[model samples]
Target: MSSEAASGMDVDGGAGRGGLTTAERTTIAAAVNAVLVHCQMASNDANFKAAIRARRKLLALPTTAQCLDVAAISDAVLEVCYAMGCGGFPWATPRWWVKRRTGGTWEDLRQCDDATDDYFKEKLRMSPRVFREIQETLSPLLQRRVTFYRVPLQPDHIIAYALYRWATGETYDSGTCSFGIVRASGITMVHDVTAALLTACPDKISWPTGLQKAVVLRAFADKGFPNCHGCIDCTHIYIDKPANANGEDYCDRRRRFSVQAQVVVDMNLRVLDVFVGYPGSVHDMRMLNLSSLWVRAESGQLFTGPPVMLPFGVRTNGYLLGDNGYPQSEWIVVPYGGLAQHPTKARFDNKQKTTRGAVERAFGRLKGMWRLFLRTHKCNMDSLPQQFVAVCILHNILIDAGVPFDDNLLWEVGPDGVRRRVDLGMHQPLRPVCMESSTGDALILRDALAERMIAQ
Candidate 1:
């Protein structure tokens, strides 16, 4: 029979014409077997149907050859199998192309020997050395959780996916496509990586003590806020409106939905402590009051020493520089608010504002580095806080790695002293009750600091 007649009859099991030649029969069997194996089809009927469908689809495409061969048929079948969630081509696997394109090795996708240091720093917001270190640190902890039966999700892939999500705030589907992870796996990777970071990197967000506390104090002193250990402020991180009954509480004064994150940062713009998950409507001071830092400071556990003697015999505990949103206390210092400010008070306010800017700089760097915090994050309300804390951990990591802060972006503090995006208009009128009554000793310490500054 003619080749065309033979090819036509081949589909009908070669019943109407001479049976297919050995080579033709072998090619058809191979194509069917490939569909069965790659697509995981259980029945011969399903495998044959998939192979025929794939062949027809390829023939219908504009770029396809008018006639097909065994290799072409196998390629078409594999493409369809992959699309149907069966298996992936070697070049399309995250273990293969993602590593090779990003300058990693084929044998070990995590290695960075092929990439320059700047490539990792710019792309991953970490140096190659840091990435390697983190990979090693997290691998043991994450291996069991992140691995799937079909494929083992490497620690590098998990870390890269988390960093990419934090840096861009992209959706899970986007991440899957970018990182070669499936949707469900991508979500799990982010969750597992975030938990791993929080578990393994607590020091990054710890309270200062001993030599660390002394170092922080000295750094703030150099910025003209004497005996100051850190700057305190709260900024709103936008989030999707929760679907719960109390979702309204998440709306901020600006009428936007958000969650408040109160952060304390040292002069180096490293976050020392972070309290997150408060609804946006909560006042910054209220959030502060609820923080463990506040609890520790009020209980006298945060700092222990004879009251630090300042110039002119003023005695005070190490204090945090805060904006008007916070009340001045033995451990917290706020700027002067009255219309009639003494020259000394004005000078003090000036220095206080300048010094308190460290927290703003810290927030700016945080959002700028992990832009996921800038916009309304599209994550479950319960998971949002973990995401925020995860980014803060990464921010501290980058700071420790000496990644320069992006100071070009400016954030504004409202009249009530809460930090908000600059483009959001002025805050609601300041409320007197928002400023808790200052203690006699707290007031006296402020006056003494002001007088001492003027004297200096």
Candidate 2:
């Protein structure tokens, strides 16, 4: 319960849920707010706590309204605001937002918390545990030191506001209806939450290191690809034409304006590395070349390891599997093409396809859980990249937590009006040309793997 409603003063004779209707609560809140007018101006700790405590009392109990000591209230509110880091005239000045409308989905928040986590999973796309963990993690950052200028929204509500918005891909106005927040506040909160999550979970989307690399190699070895680290793929994210961007540059082969995200995923479909915010018109190779991943992998910084012995007495470093759309390199291998009638080549193609599907499924699970990725977002290009990165981190976080994606959320109506599972390539542009030549040790190792597969 909120501090204002903490007193639990009900206009009702204890018949209502909290003994006070939303309106009566707001009325009491207004009286309580009066006592905070001087909280920011308070000279010392005792006076400030006393004033804040009095305000809490006003909202907590079913009480008759009385004229508050206005002078005392001003000092208290001012001191509280200053302590809150609200330094300026506008922020530190006493204000009452108690009249703001309430009672939306937030009205049932207590019930939702009290009930089973099924409600949380369905409504917010996370179990109560995951939600609480996130809330607790972000609480210290989201919480203000004081509420002298205005009552602050808790981290709990902020996270719910952002996660719900992402899960449903709903409009800003929907937050007003669902969370009873101003649409602008909802937008700010989502951005803030995204930033906080990114800060909190920076390691969620990272390259496998040290022993982790060995685990990835062994997983791929089981699939007949020795010394493999991960598979890479690119998918588009549809968005409105961002300001100051050439609209045509954002248009993909499918003619949709989008920003593309490139992902590298391990065998479990966990994101190992991610790079996003390229224009959709950019090809896969170009996107990779432009990314820090390309530089890292090329510098032997990404796949650092002692060489693994191949079946042909060959020893090589770890590499990633890619489709023909990607150019082959020592650090990455692409599927063979031409003269596919050969059983050996066909076998290699099949095996490569099997392993490469991990990245595709990674994309599927990502968009499946976060419907925001499926929608044409209005997030600015500057913020778009972080939004994608943050979502990817959350995706990996949930996977680490053993949270399951609701398959029902994965269903979407296509342009033909047929409802189906969300496509991994729903927003992907045309595939890069197969002419991207297989080159260097990547070419040699791929053939060796194929022949070894035949031998096995």
Candidate 3:
């Protein structure tokens, strides 16, 4: 007999009906109590409090919900949604690819097993509910008809579970089917749904000029940040190595080498722009140089050609906030530290230095939330950065949808008893530093001309 059976303990414990002796029952109860006691003790810890706060802030929602029962089928559907948001299974296609490339031609398909197609189809069949949900979500986003195209087991749940496990560094099974569908099906369904959701940008996202100014201004002056337009930065994510032909081109610029991405966010920590899937080896300055942002702004086409009123501050060759990675110019202002400052220019330099700190806080919020950037991602290099951009886009959607944020709950007393504005972008400090004292007061006198350009 096995050790468990020989000991007279129930071997059918997994099914939760193992008849056991009084001693066995006591051991199990003690084990359960130990876990509860440990948790109760840890709950009072300062680190746990900080963790709870950080989690609440990161999820952008309260965490007062109860534990989901095993039979909560609708809750399972939400779990499926979580799976979809994570990247779907990656290995399924490759094994299929190899078999197709060498084993048989498409004309001789009947002879070939074609495991990939069957696998994906089976996954879809098992999770009809999730598949249907994904289709529903995708239909509105794609602006095209989406009929269920089933494939064999994508093993999507396995991928999702693995990713979640890696991210949280916790043990979990992608193979668990708490939902109506099988584990793999649940995962596959969620991936499709997430893709659909990211593509679902509203027809009219309110980009009110007044609102932008108000929100930004509050996040800056009230929030103790500088150069308050928004925060800008780039990050990289790792994935499965690309095919040999495209391998070198796909390699990213990190310790482990992954695909890089660029994101721009407003002071409210809402993502405004995402430029993703560039090779990792490229520097931040290089990425910026190639970005559409650089293209539009550098060419002076932003204001002259179109009536696109750029966010925050007036045009007349308006300035952009950036870190030390960018080149210094009248249009794009970098932090004035290190050798960039001369002793004679200290007064004006201090002002510029003071304002640029907002972008740093913005970066802090971005990294603090989606910690996928905190460490290496273990998946396909090409698709990882795209996934990162997708997450940021999702974050922006949540923010737009009025999810609670840290600044929303916590209020700070501003200098001079001033209330910080969070309703719109009001807190951004005034720019055009040092120029106020320039020759002929030309920049100041010309400020009127600049206003005319802005009104245009």
Candidate 4:
């Protein structure tokens, strides 16, 4: 029995679920009693009760207000803004109001706003607005493969509501649609979007280059790495406990709990593929093996043969770089030793270490660019990895769109020809592995890097 019920709280006495343990019952009972007390406290204030009654009457008689069309629904969404703990400031309020009240979609609202296109574009691209966008986009993409259900809020709405809660650490229902209109609009939840983001890569797509790639790709080529795809690695994102028993398995190397995701981005720093939702307990090597992505490549289901060359000059064929945690196979390469040094193995060690640098640079640039990713958030465990995928897609979009920053103009050159500005990312030490040194190890390292580059 739950501890609460064991204490004789009888929390579930009224519902009579009977299955609840004593502790569960007591906890529920306490929650019920707390709500009742709050209601009584509010009732003691006559004016507050009267105002609530008046609002209810007004809400019941809503057909007259033209603002009632979308505005009423917008107001309902705004109600969620408060529930989600987005309650601190006046302006921090959800901007969905602009689009909803103005009777326009996120894109249309962007055009009318005085804010920079990038600003509005980014806000609209966030989960709150992205859910709406996905619904519109998916209807055409899915066509008839899956049945679409219309709820008071659709799947996207549920997914958005859950994501808003996860991302903002806000109360549940922070992004929900109201009862009356939810059924009308037919909100598709985000899980469907998650599925798409994970599986949507067709045989090919064009990827663009960013500053990170400009540096690393050239560096790899200069060292003679041929057909070298970008680096591949696994990173962790924190997640709340899932209801499943296997949920705990997601805890990873940092020792703190997280879900693991593997990403393969090209030399251009565009993510070519993502293998996510692995349990943290699984080692990186095991997770990589389990992924259908690798299986397809090995079985020749993808790329029609062993090698997969991405559009941005990133190619994956017989080799992929891995850390010492993984096994060194003909298809996947790892360090010569497990972080253990030996004079005789120096050359092999240098080659593996240098070759792995490209992937590290991509990851460093990725985390540095997205401040949110620099830290972690508590997310609904099942959905966390999918959210990561969305972020990756957004990152690529930003790079390709060349989303300009206001600060870019701050770097104008002076009459003396010295530019005055700071671009932190421009000089953030090309990842540790990419750093060059004149130490005694340089010769051995240089040759090994050259050999790997030629194979690339």
Provide TM-scores for the models: 0.71, 0.78, 0.44, 0.47
Give each model's clash number.
0, 25, 35, 26
State the lDDT of candidate 3 residue by residue for 1-456, as single tens digits: 633333323322343365544466457556544543444353436644543454344454323221111112223333333322222212224333332222221122223355533432222211223334334544544342211222233233322332333223221232232222444443344355446555664321222145675566456534332224455566555444655436666564333445666666555666666677776666776787788877866687532322223324433334445555554544454544455655433433454445544444544444433444444444544445545655554455445545433432122245689765321111222232343323332233223323333444
lDDT of 1: 0.71
Q: What stretches of model 1 exceed 4 Å from their correct place?
A: 1-116, 145-149, 406-436
Compose the digit string of candidate 1's lDDT tens values, residues 259-325. Answer: 8888888988889889998889999878978889888998888877446677757777788877777
- Give the Å error, residue 241, model 3: 4.9
Which residue window of length 10 is worst by lDDT in model 3? 64-73
Q: Which candidate number would show the highest TM-score if scored against the true structure?
A: 2
For model 3, the stretches where C-alpha displacement exceeds 4 angstroms are 1-187, 202-210, 213-228, 238-254, 299-317, 339-357, 401-456
Can you write out model 2's per-residue Cα lDDT over 1-456, one digit (the tens) per residue?
643343323433254354555565567557545544543454466655654675565455333332132233333444444444442233534356543657666666547445757767766777888888888888877875444445567789888888888877888886787787887788788889989988888887888887777788889999988878898889988888777889999998787889888899999888988888889988888989999998887787876777877766667778888887776667777777665358888888888988888988788788878888887868767877897888888888788899987667768788999998775553432344554464555667877787789889
Q: Each prediction's Cα lDDT score?
A: 0.71, 0.74, 0.43, 0.47
Candidate 4 on 1-456: residue-level lDDT in tens? 744434223333444454445466456556544544444453436544643554465476335323232333333433333322322223433344332321222223335455534544333334334445545654444433211121122343333333333333332232333212232122244455545544553322322245543464555445444334455677765555555656457555445566667777665556767777776677666777788767865785533223434333334443455665554443455555534656535665676567676565555545444433434444566556666676676556555555433333324465699986522121111122322322333233333443454455
Best by lDDT: 2
